[model samples]
Target: MDPLGDRVNRNGTPTVSDPSPGSEGGLALSGTRTLLLTTFTHVLVDGYGIGLSVLLALLFGRNGRFALVGLILSAYTLATAFAEPLWGRFSDATGRRGAVVGWGLVFASASFCAFGFVSPEGPWAGPLLILFALAAGAGAGTYHSVATALVNEVTSRENRGLVQGINNAGGSVGRTLFPLALAELAVVLGSPGWAVLPFAGAGVLLGLATVSAFPLASPRTFRAGTASPSPDGPMDRRFLARMVALSFLRTAFFVTAAGFLPTYLVAVRGLDERAMGTVMTLVMSTGILAQPLGGSLSDRLDRGRLLAGLLAGSGAAFAGSLLMEGLWSSVALLGISMFMVLMTFPLLFALMGDVVPGNRLGAATGLVTGAGGLAATLTQATVGVLAQRTSPVLVLLGLSALGVLSGWMAMGLRAPRSPGGRRALGS
Candidate 1:
């Protein structure tokens, strides 16, 4: 009998298997414990790490200049985009994933706390804010890709999808709650910069503490059964290029549409700021759940086919939103589209994980994520310009076209073997 439970059947479900004594297959408790801890780490890192955007709003107050805000945000995002791949390569070379993550949190948290010290009255305020933004960006880059690789290392293939789903869900929770928490804290403190300091510091301390405990809790060695060493063990540059291209296109579609959705609703649907915010919230809330659902489904189904279907559905929904007349109809279609778009997050990365060698998971993740970020930045700018010169609907139609292209790319993805010598899907 196979010791790692059973061989996955045609439907991707495992059948019955007998395990030897002390086998890794029975260590579900330890694996799950590790997963939960990792998930919590993501919450702290991603939740507060993304607070720079919120911080920008607080810095400018009611008279926020779009150009200035965009400049600083662009710096932050680009810094993150550029740094991810480097961190991934560093982690792969050093084999000190925990140390990288712990130190990264420290750097990010310090950047957040530093925000409190930058006075609006000071002449150096803008420059100081930019410095902290870049620091935060670097920290964000370090945390996510390393954490993803760590999770992939610890979990078995049978459960990786579910666990990664949970991981993505944790990030969503952070993204949803952290900004609101920071905003409320700003109200109480009457200083936007100072408001996030306490929370950021607390997160830092907690993260460091968690890292300290990792040595005791983490698996002694990555289980050999989970992945096999690659035959050549060399990077597949062509596959990486394709992944980067596809990721860029998909991320561009999401970032452009989301960045402009509020404006579109206000201009086209005549909704006020508050109502638009409500609609936006409604759309984002669905994403929190959609990621996990998508991941779980990807694990059970063929990832390429599943991803293609999702993108196509999203495109169809997006097109419907453009054509729909009523506000409710538009909201329903757009919300569904947004949910499908967000769901692609885990599926795409997990697909990469399947193809990427275990030793280079970090680098692969970093490269794709960084490229995607850069694409999002460019796409947002392009969409903004187009909206100014043409119409919001026209820009969205273009985005829908990109979505279709992305789906085609996903459909063209080749099934690659895991490090454990397992095919991604049954033949």
Candidate 2:
């Protein structure tokens, strides 16, 4: 209980909001629309995120330029790692999710346009490049964290698993198609000199999504102070231990897939960005189909067991990918391996919904994402150096081991149910 207007009568208190009953169909629809728009935005933004590196290659055209491309590739995740928990807590504390999201769009949109000023030969280019990285990352970080929180805020536990599939699928859809589209756009726009228009369009889409999310109904704040502990004893300690380690292994594998695998193709086999993007599109698009399959599989199958089985399969696929004798065969095997890699994400998100308490869901998700991002950043640099000295097969071998480790770790997790088969954790 809280006093009205800070009573000074020898007492201290805080006001709490009353729980709102009933769902707003409009808000749910609006959230759905926002997510759909977000998918489109993600494709373009991630297009800018990853494609910017290839574009920069055109600008610099130097061997050391790979370092610049690497920075561009890594910066988004690094920024998101630092910001997710902060934004999650902020959204939790204030309940101004829409406002936070709207403002995030403003920052992201401006940063996109501002990124055009980062020229290699200009006097201020070096510092401007750093600023572009910092701003793009910070803004993108805020938008994504808040958006994820909002998805949970509106969806019921019954549907969280399905929606997790949907969200990740949305992202896959974006990344899958966006690169091909942007590659064409880059050509039409004559990038490396003037490429601000595509980023500007992405910024506008973000703005539209943010504005349409207004009029969202406020959520019924859960009883955080009084909710009973999970029946699965020592929830926080056990779940955190399971999730953090799994997140690290999961992210480490993805970094290896995206960074080392591509570099291996280029260094050992000599393929360029266009060729790599073609393969990336196929791999990502498969997940648009595979994630729903994974989520449905999670419902019917033992999630932990399924994860283990998939990893063993995935590791074998990647290992075989390394041994391919020709370029065409290499691409085929890598595509299959990458598809296997993509299938894991929805299951992971669904598993989070299974294990974490609904009350503290945002924080828990943020922590998992942050841990993964940290691992990814470290893995990319390590694999890059590893590729320089040893054979590419060695890095693939290491990732194969990581996949096996991830499966073992997945085997350690058991999603328990409450007395009524209701997941107290599922958001």
Candidate 3:
């Protein structure tokens, strides 16, 4: 009569089995409820992350120092990248994924709010800004690995891609909405710090809500010791190496292109702040549809091929954008690129779940995402310095080249084997 209908072996110990589609231990909060909660949290947290760009733009103004901007951006990105594996390891060890998600959001939100209050011109602003950025990044870093691991714990393999896609789309929603919301707040409040108050407050509330919902969403069966190893066997190191490399390249491209897109719009294309925010919103909005479509396709088609094609398509679209003369036309092309780029995230997450053991999922995810973060940090810093010497457009074009290379590299990923089959790679 164990909850979850867990079967017992001859020794009377519970035998490991996948959580049945949605319910974990017959808990009130089904997989659907957990998905919903995680998705909402994703919106707020990712919104804050993307919204930082808008805040940075506001604080620095149109003609501000690109070099300094890059450094500060790198600080956050680097810390986030560095913290991912640590947080992932912690989640795996403690069986407290909910605590990680809830507290991380609260800590990041508080730090971000504090960041808004510091004057850019103040004598201590440089040190203070970097410190806050590090704090916020570390807190934000705790999110994806744990939340995703939580989602996958309850979802069946058949639905994992779709569920992850929906979860990722929530991030897209945040990325899309936050920029405009923050921009509007900036216009109304006229103080960058005060503008962040509303969003930060929302994040704090969401974090508390997550903490309260933990017991219902996470049952003991889903905890570390209760779960068993994946039948897929130990992960292939070579395949993991390939994935990490792919993640690095894609992230570097994304960070370079999207990170500087707003600046490119304002400085290179001559758009006003409001207009830039609108275009940014439009670009990210594409992900809402693209992610689900990509996820659904991955379930039926070859994930490796789909991923390669998407990366190539994204790269082609981005390259095409550079050739366009008119601003709107270029924006249209860039929007398509953004669409395809966003689609790849859930695919990557789903791919990891397919091979990695249940208990090690968090750590593996952390490593993959952490690699991407590291790439982003380096790319952001490098491009920031290079932007001073050349146009942001050229810098973006160079980054777009990395996408094509990533696509080529993605072609090497073996399809994930079915459960009870031999491992997917190095077989």
Each prediction's RMSD over C-alphas, in Å, is 7.1, 6.4, 4.5
Report the C-alpha displacement of residue 235, candidate 3, in angstroms.
2.3
TM-score of 2: 0.78
lDDT of each structure?
A: 0.68, 0.59, 0.78
Question: TM-score of the candidate numbered 3?
Answer: 0.89
Query: In model 2, which regions exceed 4 Å deviation?
Result: 1-49, 52-68, 109-130, 143-145, 192-196, 215-218, 221-235, 260-267, 389-393, 421-427
Q: Candidate order by TM-score, highest to lowest?
A: 3, 1, 2
Over 1-427, each residue of candidate 1 has an lDDT whose tens digit, in order, gives 1122234344333343443345564234334555666677677666654455555545543342434445555566677788889998898776666667777777778877786667766898878877887787788678667777767766666555666778877766665666556666776777876777776777688668656645322232444344322223677788888888888878777755665564566566666434554566666567689888988887788877778878878877888899888888888998899789778877876776666787788888899989877887676656655655677687678888878778888887776765578665420
lDDT of 3 by residue, 1-427 (tens): 3333444444434444454554432322345667887898888878877777777776664774566667777888888898888888888776667768988999999998998898987999878988998999998898887888877776666666777899889999998998777777778888877789988998899888787666222332442222322334677788789989999999888766776777667767777778878988999889889888788788777788889999988998998898799988998999999999888888888888777887788888899889999998998888888886787668777878889988998999988665578444311
Q: Estimate each model's TM-score.
A: 0.79, 0.78, 0.89
> In model 1, which range of ten residues has the least summed lDDT?
1-10
Candidate 2 structure lDDT: 0.59
Best by TM-score: 3
- Candidate 1 pairs with clashing backbones: 227-419, 227-420, 228-419, 228-420
Over 4 Å off, model 1: 1-30, 57-64, 113-126, 187-189, 215-220, 223-232, 256-281, 315-331, 381-401, 417-427
